[model samples]
Target: MIKAVHGDITKLQGVSYICNAANGIGPMGGGVAAAIRKAGGKEIETEAIKVCKEQNPMPGDLYVTHAGTLPFQGIIHLVTMKQPAGPTSYDVVRTCLHNLVAYCRKQGIDKVALPALGTGVGNLDKAKVAAIFKEVLEPVKDIEFIVADIDQDFIALFA
Candidate 1:
């Protein structure tokens, strides 16, 4: 079953992959990207760039790359925003998660990890964000979802 948890993104146990809230260019930006880079190293950045080049992912599009140095088996980086740079919104969050599920299904994966998609730099409202996720995800029963919100209030919304 899909579950919500509050924890460090770097230390998620058992899940094979995590979603990176990346930009169109696909570099490791701040927040979750920074934390993943700190644990996984720059090779992750290089691999993401390679995939980003081929995909040119816009908001809601999904890109896949090997985890590089991440402890996880692979990374499914979602471009949650357009190039100008900044916090993502509810639209970005909702679409990114859909893209993520599609990619996960393609790869024969049933369980995955995610950070709160547009909340950090995106500055999206927590209640709205949680509601959007629950709405989109409440119906997809093919796979199990695990999203980690860095903040506590978001966790309550999901709980």
Candidate 2:
């Protein structure tokens, strides 16, 4: 099941993994990623950097890391761009969603909190990103996805 919510994704309850619209280089410095780091702790970023060193994940790849102080199983860093603050495209977002669903199915992740992908520093339009999410994820039947954002326009797309 999927639903839209207006709030901070970092503060969402019952979700073990919250999707971070991350850059490939690994730094949770801005936007929702920053908020999550602040709440979860610097350890989360440290783990992310370690993963980057090991795998150097590209756009559309889902990198899993420890949640630090946050009360959850893990954090899913959705690499949307190659570097921090770089732009991302709709196609990348689609690939990320597709990979996320596959990863969730393979890893048994049932619930997730996801924010608007590539709408921040990536500069993609919220509605278009939302459409891509719906296109790639609407067919998914097992995962309980919460498409969350503070922006009403983004949430309205899911509604």
Candidate 3:
């Protein structure tokens, strides 16, 4: 079942993994990445950098790493933008969700906590972003997808 809730993603429960809205280079600089790094520890950023060096993820790509001290088993860093200041496209968001779902299936992760991709710093429209997620993930079975945020506007989209 796919559900939307108002809460902190870092403190999410019963999810196998959580996603970070990251850049292509994988620095946990600000916004969602910063929050995850602050809660999960610096090691999360370090491991993400290692994966970034190896994979050199581009926009619309994804890299996975251990969740560090966070409760979840893994952190799926979704690269929604190449640069922090760059504008995000709908295709980029769609691709990121697509890659995330594929990775979850491969890792046998049955549940995931996802933030509003590109909405924090990228300043994308919340409803549009939410719709994109619904489009990409609605058909996938078995995986419990949770679109989490503290913002009422964001949570209302899922409702």
Candidate 4:
């Protein structure tokens, strides 16, 4: 059931869970995080920040929290901003996604969604982003990987 798809994650229906391209601050903003917050509500952000702050996972770390206004059971927040080297996050994109996926898999989560990290705030290449994901996830068997690209051209490029 783990596969890639092109769709609007905010409007995603009948799904049990999705991942947010959350910043280290753990607040909601534009792009996938914004859409999830807009769909789910502020409760999601509140719960996520609380959980993340409590556990205090280092950069390249990931945590989970209630979806609140979002449609899934929970949201997986990955700390792509605080990676070991620095905030210059281009190198962390794949590691972050891989860690995000691994964190989900460890929890017995088989179905989930994700957005292209590093592309928005991180300013990375589109092809490389897609390739990194494909490389990291192609070997996994159970986790359903859905990529949400709200733009048609963006979706086509990934397609």
Model 2 C-alpha lDDT per residue in residues 88-126, reported as the tens digit of each score: 889999999999998999999999989999999988998
For candidate 3, the lDDT comes to: 0.87
Put down candidate 4 lDDT per residue, 1-159, tens digits, no spaces: 334457777677666677766666567766677777777888887886777677776656777778875557887776666432235355577777778677776778776777777666666777777777778877777777777766554455555
Who is ahead in lDDT, 2 or 3? 2
Best by TM-score: 2
The deviation in Å at residue 63 for candidate 1 is: 0.6
Window of ten residues with lowest summed lDDT in model 1: 82-91
Cα displacement (angstroms), candidate 2, residue 23, comes to 0.6
* Each model's Cα RMSD: 1.6, 0.9, 1.2, 3.0
Error of 2 at 59 (Å): 0.8
How many steric overlaps are in each model, in order? Answer: 3, 0, 0, 4
Per-candidate TM-score against the hidden true structure: 0.91, 0.97, 0.95, 0.84
User: How displaced is residue 150 in candidate 2, in Å?
Assistant: 1.9
lDDT of 1 by residue, 42-135 (tens): 8888877777788788888878767766678887777878663665677778888777777878888888888777777777888898888888
Ranking by lDDT: 2, 3, 1, 4
Candidate 1 displacement at residue 61 in angstroms = 0.6
What is the Å distance of residue 51 in model 1 from its true position? 2.2
lDDT for position 124 in model 3: 89
Q: Any runs in candidate 3 off by more than 4 Å, and if so which?
A: none
